[model samples]
Target: MAEASLLAASIAVLVGTVAILVNRVRTPAWVRDAQLTLNASAVTSLLLLVCGALLVALVLAFGIFLLATRHGVVGRAMVCLAATGIAHLGVTVRRH
Candidate 1:
């Protein structure tokens, strides 16, 4: 039962992260402006793409951690980190 709950929670976080990435990609200009405030316009787009890729990498890392680790402090910590990422993404999504 506990394992099931943990799996569900991990999946939810993965989905949320992907959703946020998709929404950000849909508005490249906004993402560039928001993420690279001081950078030149020419480079902002590339930087934004890097940021998106980084987020995708983070999600992948977290997913792998969740899958490969056993239920314990490490698992709980990963879940907490995932939740934090989701909440941060939620705020970012709302802002733009």
Candidate 2:
């Protein structure tokens, strides 16, 4: 599930990045406005991608931790949630 989420997120971010790059070369005001929209979309997609990647990283880390000593579901869950929140916050900050 985590891998699937990460894949989807990365694809979305990649698409958004491409769209932004395409829009950036335009010349008109209306076209520039449209590019701004693309920028917002790219930023949002990037945030989701970052969060998903972090979650995958956390899952791997927890898997290792489980092999070491005690199993901890709470810590892993916290890591995932924190990664998501931080990604969202980063997007919000970047937007403003």
Candidate 3:
């Protein structure tokens, strides 16, 4: 179970990293941001946050699709749910 959890997390991180690279790590308006600061560190942090959120959302949606198609494991579905929940908490805290 631990290994499965780690594998899921590792894949998520890899996907997020690839997304960041593909976007050239630019702070784009693909996601709405109310924060007006455009400093270098802020831009990088926002990029990371956006990519992480997208990754979490994708994983959660994929799990739901799988279940709907009768191709999902309950454990993996639970893992995806927990991942999104944890990610939401982290993003909420960091954004504030």
Against the true structure, whose TM-score is highest? 3
Query: TM-score of each candidate?
Result: 0.40, 0.32, 0.45
On residues 10-91, what C-alpha lDDT tens digit does candidate 2 reach at each position?
Answer: 5566456545544543446755564477477776756766666676576556655654554444344444444444444444
Residue-level lDDT tens digits of model 1 in 1-96: 776676667667767767776677679696677656534464655575557557755865775576577545446546555555655555454444
Error of 3 at 93 (Å): 3.3
Whole-model Cα lDDT of every candidate shown, in order: 0.60, 0.53, 0.56
Q: Which consecutive 10 residues in model 1 have the weakest lDDT in total?
A: 87-96
RMSD of 3: 10.2
Better structure of 2 and 3 per TM-score? 3
Question: How close is each model in CA RMSD to the real structure?
Answer: 7.5, 10.0, 10.2
Cα distance off (Å), candidate 1, residue 2: 1.3
Global lDDT of model 2:
0.53
lDDT score for residue 72 of model 3: 48
- TM accuracy, model 2: 0.32
Displacement of residue 52 (Cα, Å) in model 3 is 0.4
Q: lDDT, candidate 2, residue 72? A: 42
